[model samples]
Target: MSNLIRLIIGFALVGAAVALFIFGHWGWGLLAVFFSICLFVTYFYNENMLIAQWYLRKDNMDKAAVFLGRITNYETQLNRMQHGYFNLLIGLIESRTAPMKSEKYFKAALNLGLHMDHNIALAKLSLAGIAMAKRNKREAQMYLADAKKADKNKLLADQIKQMKDQLGMLDRQTQVRYSHR
Candidate 1:
């Protein structure tokens, strides 16, 4: 349906431009046609980006990666597509059973050359979570602190604060238990 609408609108604009040229209003018609073309291109790119993001968020990492890879090929100059690719890599990392593979994905995301605040924060948080899982308190704290510094969302800020507090408590508990041994 949307494709049909786009087709209709495209033809309508072209027809209007032709009509205007025939009626001696060529300048306005040409401008309208140019603007319409620009609008269509922008909309197409944004729609593809949104689809990539949706697939990534849904945990369909393979599909998301494919889509994002296609987008990157289609728009070589668009850095935002790398953001989508990084997010898919993050998802892939989170799904891995092995810490080494997970770390690889996290590092791959970092190497993507795109550093939106949220994406960077998410990568840091993922690393922090992995550190916590491995009982590496110092590494977790470092990642958590980086995540906190990269925070763009106040809610995420609060969540990170709570996570740090929980991690601290866990560390204290571990120390106490080991000390009693």
Candidate 2:
């Protein structure tokens, strides 16, 4: 189900729980509350992710960050796939501000297993960008290769080609500089 639908259902459950409590049905009210809490835990990360993506699509980085930040202790609350996506979201957002920190998040997401070729490719491509920025040509090349392999849909073809061209240029420049010395 969509996050919006889940959120509506959760709110309904909470409202019903409150109504039941007010009517003095203690047992049913407590049961409703328990179910509502479970639903909240399930939907919290999903809803935040949806909102964060919307903000990101609008280029509202600050707003996106705020929404993403609302998903606290996600490692425990979320399932494996969600946990991986949570880290991926954090990595993508943080890569703009704190690059070094983003690397760890990306790696964590990868280790947790994204389970999608596109997502895995994206993470690897981001790692390649990080490696390139740090002037680690070999590491960048490794990541680029992995990204290419993981991109079964060829969604990252343009980016892979661009990075390859950049790496080639860097290699030529390095060779020329060394030869002139």
Candidate 3:
């Protein structure tokens, strides 16, 4: 549903609740108010994306992708603030099956901009990993630095450390390859 339509429905429900209150229909008024709040909630949290994130947490990428697929045109279905999150979820689900293909989604998510610093960090970390796989050490290091900066709460401290360690291994492999000459 479009954000405008959701807003309209929320307003309509609130209007109905007011009319019910005026008529002393207390129970119906309360119910209408509850539904109105739910409609408003969709502005910040799209149901499809929320369910997809839940499936992701459960380690069920198939189910997560299915839910994300429901949003045919995310621009129309999700609010501006939610656009970044929608892309982030898609990137996460795709990363499980198609690691390289997920790079674009992660890039889009970063471009769209997530509100949470931790989410930004996760996307950067994923990008760093992708770059490392492609043997782009400089790009990977840059992304790792950005990811470290964005991870303000230390939520991704372990992952960041691990990535650095992997970079060290890459150095060792390079040294061995050069020493063979």
The per-candidate count of clashes, in order, stands at: 0, 0, 0
Model 2 Cα lDDT, one tens digit per residue, 34-119: 98887776565477787887888798889999988887777655555788888888898998899878999999999988888989
Q: Rate the local accuracy (lDDT) of all candidates.
A: 0.68, 0.87, 0.93
Q: Total clashes, candidate 2?
A: 0
Off by over 4 Å in 3: 19-27
Q: In candidate 3, what are the lDDT values of residues 1-181, reduced to their tens digit?
A: 7778899999999999999999999999999999999999876799888889999999998998899999999887887888888988988888888989999999999999899999999999999999999999999999999999999999999999999999999989999999999
Model 3 clashing residue pairs (backbone):
none
Tell me model 1's lDDT, rounded to 2 decimals. Answer: 0.68
**Model 3: per-residue Cα lDDT at residue 82:** 86
lDDT of 1 by residue, 70-96 (tens): 545433434454554444354553555
Model 1 misplacement above 4 A = 1-49, 58-84, 87-93, 96-100
What is the model-wide C-alpha lDDT for candidate 3? 0.93
Worst 10 residues of 3 by lDDT: 41-50
Q: For candidate 1, what is the TM-score?
A: 0.59
For residue 115, model 1's alpha carbon misses the true position, in angstroms, by: 3.2
